[model samples]
Target: MSTPRHTLAQLCAAVTAAPVLLVAPAAVAAPQAPPPSTVIGGERLGLPGVQVDPLAGAPALPTDLTGESWIVSDATSGDVLASYNPHARLPPASTLKILFADTVLPKFDRNAVHRVADEEIQNIGAGSSLVGIKENLDYRVEDLWRGVFLSSGNDAVHVLSHMNGGIQPTVDEMQSKADALQARDTTVVSPDGYDRDGQLSSAYDLSLFARSGLRNADFRMYCATREAMFPGAVDKNTGQRSSFGIANTDRLLGKYPGLIGVKNGTTTNAGSTFVGAAERDGRTLLVTVMHPASYQRVYDETAELLDWGFASAGKVRPVGRLVEEKQAGGEQPSGQAGGTAGAPPPHPAGAPAGPVAGSAGDDGLGPVGWSAVLVGALVGAGAVVVLRRRTANRAGRLWK
Candidate 1:
């Protein structure tokens, strides 16, 4: 019997040609500096030494989509199923509220009441969305969240930011939360996601924020809610109390089967950006689409991606692993990538072990690259092969 043989050069060439899924180590060191660019290029998207199966028999990716960047992944497993320009930084519009909710929702008591101040609602740009918050009106924290989620109200976001501390401090904390989540592509200059200089996030980062926020019961309920009767404000002069209804901006909810709450945004610069999640047969899938040409296109493209992902779940192989959250104290377990939980067991000598590649350096070719190829024999034999590699060079590591 002939033994299967694979060489470093052969594996390197193959990995360089296609996307490779990576399992992240348990711990990672704190970054010394931010990445030079926010865009996650194709070269850095894949993990070296890992080979994924091609989506040969699955539904084809959407072609007529107008979004500038998009991504679909398994919500539970954090597996990136498909993406296009996943890391291209662009205006996020109101979807940035997901991050805001993640950062501040836990800080305040849901039943706590805060009186709206004129200064807290000041500086909301003209033509921005609002929930009709009035000065001197006391509102429960839960009601404010409903306003923010149901109406995409900038007013609610500003008021909440003020409660947390101030607008600037809330923005800084949100940015820090993004960094801790390993969502390096996000830069938060506005809590409400209104257009501002240097306020941007990528499809990948938006998806990350949504997934993280979903862990909170309040965030999930707010986004999933279709309609709610908001708290009534008492008329300062007339002494009359009035309440109004608000509907979720996310069109996918109730419209798409198995669709749950997420969020949506639109603006002159951002066009339409949406994050959607759906569950089927115990599996949940999340999709993020940004900068669609039209409001309807965001939903359409997201639905298409979700349909493809559900159908392709077991059939299609992963091109890249979603980077996991860095553990506390800045210590990562050695020899594993983002998705892998713990240190990997050592392999025997001369085994078919593949080396994991680090980020690219000055040279165009880094220590490793990944590719997907049809392995007829392996597929026919019902065998999946994982190539493991380890290198000493850590400079410019892909996941900082």
Candidate 2:
């Protein structure tokens, strides 16, 4: 006998009368599979069902980017405006130092001094960049950060990492921090971001790190500094203290109008990677370009992306969400009403529970999903009927 066809009203009534399953919402809302275009190495780079659409009314998205992966996002709202292969994992080079700084920069007092050990300097890879640090020199935390930011100094990263505890512990902590930030594409084997086996990060994750790091005033200052004198050791032969001026490696800082401090990185394997930020007309945009064919291409592409982001901020729709930072214990903030476990706690009375920054789409729903529970419920009954029919049709075909 053919299965009885249920009308939409009947399906709604059936769904309403059915015993409700009391499973946690998270169990029901399993992460959706990302689109095929956003996948790399079988891993989805973006949230499932999220589409990377261009700005609705802005100029066409830049087509000349030579990087393997790139992203442009609103720093204030955390919305990704445009991206290409954002999750493609590649060598991070010095760009990984941003994560290292984010992890350890807050742990020590910038005014405090630490003596550099020979082992710290010795561990840097050959031909790697250095801030000209020397053993037995006591350098202030502030000076070390300058070296790391201005000169892309591997030596400075090691000294700071050593101060945090040890190189290995620092690396471990950085990995932990990346996890907390939901930067799932990052893996840190070296504190200084030198080429190491399995040391990789995606453009999306790198932008996330840069965004988080920028929240710190010191981090912002370090990356924006055009030129600063770095402390150096007193020559034993001459018994005279010397200091060297380090210029910011990020070419976009002073050269690009409205550009601010961030970072840049390059290596034979990594090619060129850059995370940049700019503000125009009170709106700030962040861009990340990874593994461009040439060092200059990173900046050119970044500028193009930033310009697009600034122009499209209010006009363009978001394609994907930058996942929120996870609180300790592996629970994500609940999206349900009444704020269940993992939900953001209620704000004080009269205070605004402002629109959440960094959500996937403009309404927090892409073309594939609903933005709010009320909206979803309005069509829930119809959805149930369609879903049931599809399931039944498949079952009948199997039987035939």
User: Measured by TM-score, how close is model 2 to the native structure?
Assistant: 0.72
lDDT of 2 by residue, 133-187 (tens): 9898789899999999999999898888777888899999999998887776788
- The Cα error of candidate 1 at residue 223, in Å, is 0.6
The 0-to-1 C-alpha lDDT of every candidate, in the order given, reads: 0.73, 0.73
TM-score per candidate, chains pooled: 0.72, 0.72
Q: How far in Å is the alpha carbon of 161 misplaced in model 2?
A: 1.1
lDDT of 2: 0.73
lDDT for each residue of candidate 1 in 1-400, tens digit (9 for 90 to 100): 2424666456555445542322222222222323232122222342222123546577667678788788888888777777777767799999999999989999988899999999989999889999889898889898999999999899999999999889999999998888777776789999999999989998888888888988888888888899999877777799988888888888889989999879999999889999999999899899999988788999999999888888887887665545555667755435324422222322322332232334333221233521211332222212122211212124334323
